[model samples]
Target: MKIQKSFAQSVGTLYLVPTPIGNLEDMTFRAVKTLQTVDLIASEDTRNTQKLLNHFEVKVPQKSLHEHNYNERIPELLDFLRDGKSIAQVSDAGMPSISDPGHELVVACIEADIPVVALPGATAGMTALIASGLLPQPFYFYGFLQRKKSSQKKELEDLRNQTATLIFYESPHRVKETLKNVAEVFGNREVVICRELTKLYEEYLRGTAEELIEYLSEHSLKGECCLLVSGATEIAEEEVFEGTLKEQVEALISEGQTSKEAIKSVAKRHNLKKQDVYKEYHEL
Candidate 1:
């Protein structure tokens, strides 16, 4: 076990700095000072970070460390640290390594016995959750979902029974489709859509999943979105089933129930339509 006394070591430290999500005022004093003092700043997007640096009057040199180049750049950054020159790692916005690059570099630093310092700052997931009016404690932050519909549905099926409030980051282009999938799998539960967080256009739209879907059908959304969904409430005694809908339907068929009878029974047991159960059983 290696212990890190942040300032005690002669080797350079890897500072994980969090950039503002949107509003420039969200940048913290310590974060700015860290950026100003660090020997080099590794940014996900140098062009975007340059704007932030210019605003803060931080003229520190920056190197690119994005998803595509993280593996190749890790060793180079570690070398700089070994040379007693501290480095700062920042993403396009918010904390690094949270659905962004920097996790791998952090791991490498720990293994190499280099100190890593993380400064508290903006994070879109938590920003949306606190204002979502949902249960703040016991939340599951799921950053982005599978872009494919089938994969996303399967993931939702696994999370359908989780009791924790669910938080998801989604792009504007796919938010509507994701809401429809959530409604289909998790039922029309209460949900909140937080968009353009910490910006002038920041807005929160609260409604049931179905209602949100209907609203999105009429209103086009822009910018990043955070979806906060209420957790699965206690399942009714009669509604609980032993296996998946398809499995239960097949089991009923084996117990001398006709296909139609099995489908209806499974549907009723899971609060689904008989046609849906039938279609799912046949893989249609």
Candidate 2:
């Protein structure tokens, strides 16, 4: 385990800065200052990041670091950091490594004993989650699903038994199709589609998967979308409980539920007090 003191001053650091997802005002003061002070800014798209820099009047020079060039660029960035030159990494929008470039660079930096400081600003997944009208906490942030229908459905099926809220990012053109898969695999569960977040025309579409699929059938959606799906219900959880109370709880635990969650599910299924279920599951 390596401990990183971000501001050690002896060695150069890599700052993971966040940019606004849609509205430019979401950029944080610290993020701008870090960008301005860094020796270099490694951006997923130099052209896209340039507009943000121009707006904030940050004069820092930028280098391209997208998926295509990351393999070749990581070495150069390591060299820059080793030379005691701090750098800031940013994506087109939102946090640097959330469904964007920078994760690999971060790993490289860690392995090389370089300090990496991340500044929180904006993230489309969390932004959409809080307003999704779904359970906010205990959420699973699945960035993007496979483009193919079979693979997407298979992936959804694997997550069907999960009890946490699921978040996904999708292009507008594929939103309707993705919803159709959700409806078929997960049934008519409650789903929310957040579009154009933080922009003037931002919109949220809330309904059952089937309902939104039908709405999009007649309408066209613009802007990138965040799709939130409610997770497995109590009814679905009960379906897997087929044996004794202790055995049932163990089964849920084996399926990745925590001991507390397994006890709660067992209690809910049998209409027993949580204490009673917990006692039985613990063999106390």
Best by lDDT: 1
lDDT of 2: 0.92
Question: Mind giving the per-residue lDDT tens digits that candidate 2 earns over 245-271?
Answer: 899999999999999999998997777
Candidate 1 ranges with C-alpha deviation above 4 Å = 235-284
Model 2 lDDT at residue 105? 97
Q: Cα RMSDs of all predictions?
A: 5.8, 10.2
Clashes of 2: 0
Candidate 2 lDDT trough over 10 residues, lowest sum: 233-242
lDDT against the true structure, per candidate, is: 0.93, 0.92
Estimate, for each residue in 1-284, the C-alpha lDDT of model 1 and write its tens digit: 67789889999999999999999999999999999999999999999999999999999999999889988899999999999999999999999999888899999999999999999999999999999999998999989899999999989987898888999999999999999999998999999999999999999999999999999999999999999999999653334568777899889999999989999988876768888998999989
Tell me how far the alpha carbon of residue 110 in candidate 2 is from the true structure, in angstroms, after superposition: 0.4
Residue pairs of candidate 1 with colliding backbone atoms: none
Q: Report clash pairs, candidate 2.
A: none
